[model samples]
Target: MDKPKAVTAAAHKLARLICSMLTQGEAYTDQGQVCCEERYRQCVLNKLNKRAQQLGMTLVPAAPAAQAG
Candidate 1:
């Protein structure tokens, strides 16, 4: 939960992933920031939607605003 602990946990996970790739003779492919951010956004949305359903509510997307000339 705290910064140090979160960093350590993430480092451990990355180490394990790298080890796995090395053993499997696989190259690491970077998904890039945009892909990672989209995945995280979708994950958060899924959690929010689930909570809303539990509270007898629903989540809706806002309408796109019109472009100003």
Candidate 2:
């Protein structure tokens, strides 16, 4: 498989692992209930962003609303 395909597959595997861990309540830290939600979000986002760039797609930030004339 190519690099892009490999990355995509790895991302999917990571997502599935995260889901399984969540379902089993094994995704929390040792501090009882400390969740790494933000870390997971960043991980997924970073992977997707990298994939998008590799695909030659520009990930533009949302545009601000224009001021009324």
TM-score per prediction, in order, is 0.77, 0.38
lDDT score for candidate 1 against the true structure: 0.97
Stretches of candidate 2 off by over 4 Å are: 1-35, 63-69
Residue runs of model 1 more than 4 Å from their true location after superposition? none
**Cα displacement (Å) at residue 21, model 2:** 24
Q: What's the TM for model 2?
A: 0.38
Error of 2 at 35 (Å): 5.1
Q: Note the Cα lDDT for every prediction shown.
A: 0.97, 0.82
Best by TM-score: 1
Clash pairs, model 2 backbone: none
lDDT of 2 by residue, 15-65 (tens): 988898888978633543235776777798888899999999867668999
Clash numbers, per candidate: 0, 0
| Residue 33, candidate 2: C-alpha displacement in angstroms | 5.9
lDDT for 56 (candidate 2): 94
Where does the lowest 10-residue lDDT sum fall in candidate 2?
A: 27-36
